[model samples]
Target: MDPPTRSWSIYNRTEITQRYEILERIGSGAYSDVYRARRLSDDLIIALKEIHDYQSAFREIEALEILQKSPNIIVLHEYFWREEEDAVLVLEFLKTDLASVIREAKRNWENGISVGEIKWWMIQILHGLDACHRNSIVHRDLKPANLLISSDVVLKLADFGQSRILLEPGFVTGDEHTHPHEQNTPSQTWMLQQPETIPESDNSNQEQITMSKEEYFKELDDLKAKDSVDETDKETNFNDGDTSCLATYTTSDMEDNPFKSSYSYEAESEGDRSGALTSCVGTRWFRAPELLYGSMDYGQDIDLWSLGCIFAELLSLKPLFPGTSDIDQISRIISTLGNLTEEAWPGCSKLPDYGKISFGKIENPLGLEAYLPNRSSDEIHLVRRLVCYDPASRATAMELLHDKYLNVNPLPVPVNELRVPSTNNGQDESSPGQWRDYKDMDSDSDFEEFGTVDASTTGTGFSIHL
Candidate 1:
């Protein structure tokens, strides 16, 4: 069969080299490399992400295109794609991520992260996730490293390579394999613009501390309403000429990389692509119980479990469950939350590998309080809302936004007040290690290899594909 054909050549390496000056390599993984670059026309810095895997590139482009309008989500200025060439995405540059902030707090702060700062970070994260969830997009990989912080102190959700779109019930498509950018026009340029600053709260309202919880919630409601109106006005005032679908070029070739040898650009039928949706995808430490049981069907709730783990880390300055392997991860979870049973999750026993894996019963569990000894009851309750065994019981991002803890006194601080850590030219050097991508396997037999390999040997986090 002839290989699938691209509709048009968006942009090539020559155009990219002429338009942007490549600064330095900021991050790299098995499937992609991110570089800090400056757009020549306006001297604005941006991130150029070159993805080697076709599937990953397509997924990230589709997800970012749908979410580019959201202030809390990373902006995708444009992308370049061509047959037999790696897809390069032009994205907003962020100096650091939440992982860096947590690390700095642990090292520099004697008392740890302030309550107001924690609330601010949590709010921004929820806003980003709410945008994704509202669009029916599930960010299967939601971790600190993926939540990037800009120089303006604004937090945006980055790294949508592992994202998936869930069709509404009864919805169907005529061409399931169609590429998202196939119908777009040939390359055009997007004018560079300075990053907008997040509005700061007025200090004149210091007396807000004396207000009741009900009044405080009302004040926040009004603030959000005003912000929504302001966003609408900005959208209305935007110039059409400033935004266009454009592409950048890169000269690097991946043909010699051993990891690039297995990738295929062939288009698969809808039936063949069905398995891709259910594949095991996520960092092991923050993965949900259903995923660990080899369940083929899961949803956005899996991200909530990861959020819980991240929030716990923020509070304590360490991972909530730092399991060395998949088995260890499960054991740690059970030891904290008790044995998995029908009582906690009615349909859990029906999971694909439920019968294959077993653990000794734990009459009593350690609970979240034991690990979070210094946190308040309210803070502990917030984590419990998301870390539960049942996916259905997990709190939605919108619901969490209105939680009493965020609305009460000592509310989230302004964006400028956030203590953002310095980074080496937009690169996060404090990351524990790079994320290793495993080759995709269609058989259930490969599940045994999950997290079995020592992370130290690979110098990467425990990640697998099944």
Candidate 2:
């Protein structure tokens, strides 16, 4: 039995007949089922995130609206809800996610995705994050799978279910009983009738929509060329907050989850469970020290720490701090970052849950460079600034964007040239920065589906498996 809420836009195969041609189930996560559906109007294929929980769906809708103009943030097309049925979100369809890309890169190349690509992806993420911060929103969950890539290879931030608005009024307000009408839609209705960001077989709009090589390199040089960071900025450090990132703040499942289906149940309160939100948030691998202390008052600084962890992972091809539990997470952080004292992290002993964990007295010489020996020193320095003990010292998204590493000689591959984990065919489609002709694809299907698609050219018969 369905919950007494709203009707699902395209509940089953039958519902998609005239409205949308349901191609396949792209994915299913904790909150909703993501599908690749083709709009019958112009044969435009879009992603439908069908959500059963209205609150989660509502949050994502709200965030997307505020972040619609953000360069690398995912674009929302239209949204609707049918009471007692489901809430359907119409969004630009993306080919694969960063997680799938990472997996495919590891398979194709033993070393994993290149450093330039990592820097490129991070720059895009920072732009999206900066946009979120400017809009007073916090994406509590940031992971590989949540970052989707278009067919043209542009990366965008997706999945705002766990995001929180820092605006004065906060998430939802106003009278609940007020019925939604055509003129007066719900607060989450943010539909923009703009051209689809992710194009399908519509080659006519390729040049304008596709990410160009010049644009790609120019964007990479943007942050660095925009400003300068002094020695004080680089040396700024503190340790007031405990460095134990409540990696398992909510549950053990957050250990290395790609923000897919981790949050199944609520978490027990630890400390200072008042203010903006609870302390139980973030994934194990990318959590910050202050978050581990159950500090509900923490701000966007926590995200910088997570970004550092992510940046390090991208370079190393594995998580920098792979802690299974809260205590283990803290220890891992301390071992890599070294123990903190009151002199460094002022008022460290005063935190609510301080001294609850222990670690080695000194740090290991086999530091970040041990795994990333070949990477530029500047990149390593940037990562160190991000994963610092003091949240106050961590660089903001905008600041990190200006780091010199992004402007280095080996520029990131352009969008058309950037290939992902699931899309790596043995054949070279074109030069690194150019795209393959859409007409040449085996006439089997209008679009390609990940995971199940076979790389065979000689076969006579064809099949489309969702």
Candidate 3:
């Protein structure tokens, strides 16, 4: 457990105060670098991630802290800002990830992954999502690369940079996680260089009216002033007009309660905590429609959408919607599910990102069924329902687990049975109880400290353990 030595300075602006005995570079990324460090305290190996962007690192730390109690989440043991060095994250490591498996499957066969493996993988992902939802955390970024598989096939959700712990708004602390591929790719380039662009509407009628920059600013200022006045009036007349507020403007107005006064202070505080919770989660592709459409408030159902996508990827061996851009992704969804109708667009005009696409000219309207030709009819139905563009209509994580599609298929093996045994491979055994076993190498103590346990070690030659 000595710190790594500096053969060469890492140029990402992260100063190395004390040399960590420079083990091989485990992984690198656009914004940060990861190294396996041996803690001097107990010689306990831990994953050390050096992050350059202060805001994003903070977001990630917050997420890990919020869910540290959950076994399914990668543990963030310690974090500290070093005045002379880069911000550091100390984490528990796992063996493999779902992304590596999919890549391997694709590498072996151009046709991609088998249907059976995909089903097996999805069930595990659902289990992980269920855990996150119960804890009231949203993994805003859910993709193959972020999911780490242990040697035991115990999948631990990693990378919380974009995740948020759905607590009260004002109390929020900035902490976010970054994608692994983004970190490991070449320095000069990135997988996602820019936020995906929202495409212009092909339909002229739906285009936003062209406003000069000055006019746009003027209109924004006017709206801000109007909103301020409206808030002031509402505050002044709260007692008299609480019930008269418009439905669109209404939030749970349960600040006053007689029952709370009857309880002890601790009980009352607990009740208050239960009453105040609301948030959204999932990546753009996996984002529930309600969040993207700008619903004022949302909840964990957004994460369910991501579960559906994970289910699909584990089954299909590719991203369900590999959208080139936001516009393209939306079109792919609309093309699969048919377009939004007037019934679906109650106040679409007010949405900032809403614009027209050729829903009217759709070549096929059967939606998900058209794309999932290989799937059983029931499975296709489940995906469609879970990934519904409307957040309200999307299925909850618990509901999805109980869906007939999951239950009807050859059900998953008990997590223990399917899990790669530690004895089966020696790599994970080095850490004993600390790491999960994937069918990978026999000796991996070197990488254990960095939160990466190579599950592809079973001499299986690059397998997806999850």
Top of the candidates by lDDT:
1
Worst 10 residues of 2 by lDDT: 239-248
Candidate 3 lDDT score relative to the true structure: 0.46
lDDT of each: 0.63, 0.56, 0.46
Residue 409 displacement in candidate 3 (angstroms):
5.0
lDDT of 1 by residue, 1-466 (tens): 2211532222336657787777755554455666777889899898877776545565677677656657888888767765456678888877767866876777678988899999999999998998887777888777776787777887888777767767531222323322221112111232221122211243231111334334533443443333212332322221111011111112121211111112122222111333335435666667788877767588889999999998998898877876545566677798899888999998998987676666666777899998899899999999999999999999999899998999998988887778877652221235323211121211123325444432222232232211
Instruction: Compose the digit string of candidate 2's lDDT tens values, residues 319-413.
Output: 67755455556656665666766765776666666654333356343467765667778879988888788778889888888888887767776
Between prediction 1 and prediction 3, the one with superior TM-score is 1
Off by over 4 Å in 1: 1-12, 168-271, 274-276, 424-466
Candidate No. with top TM-score: 1
Looking at model 1, residue 462 earns an lDDT score of 31
**CA error at residue 185 for candidate 2, angstroms:** 7.6
Relative to the unseen true structure, what is the C-alpha lDDT of residue 64 in candidate 1, on a scale of 0 to 100?
76
TM per candidate comes to 0.70, 0.66, 0.57
Which ranges of candidate 2 are over 4 A from the true structure? Answer: 1-18, 169-261, 264-275, 363-366, 422-466
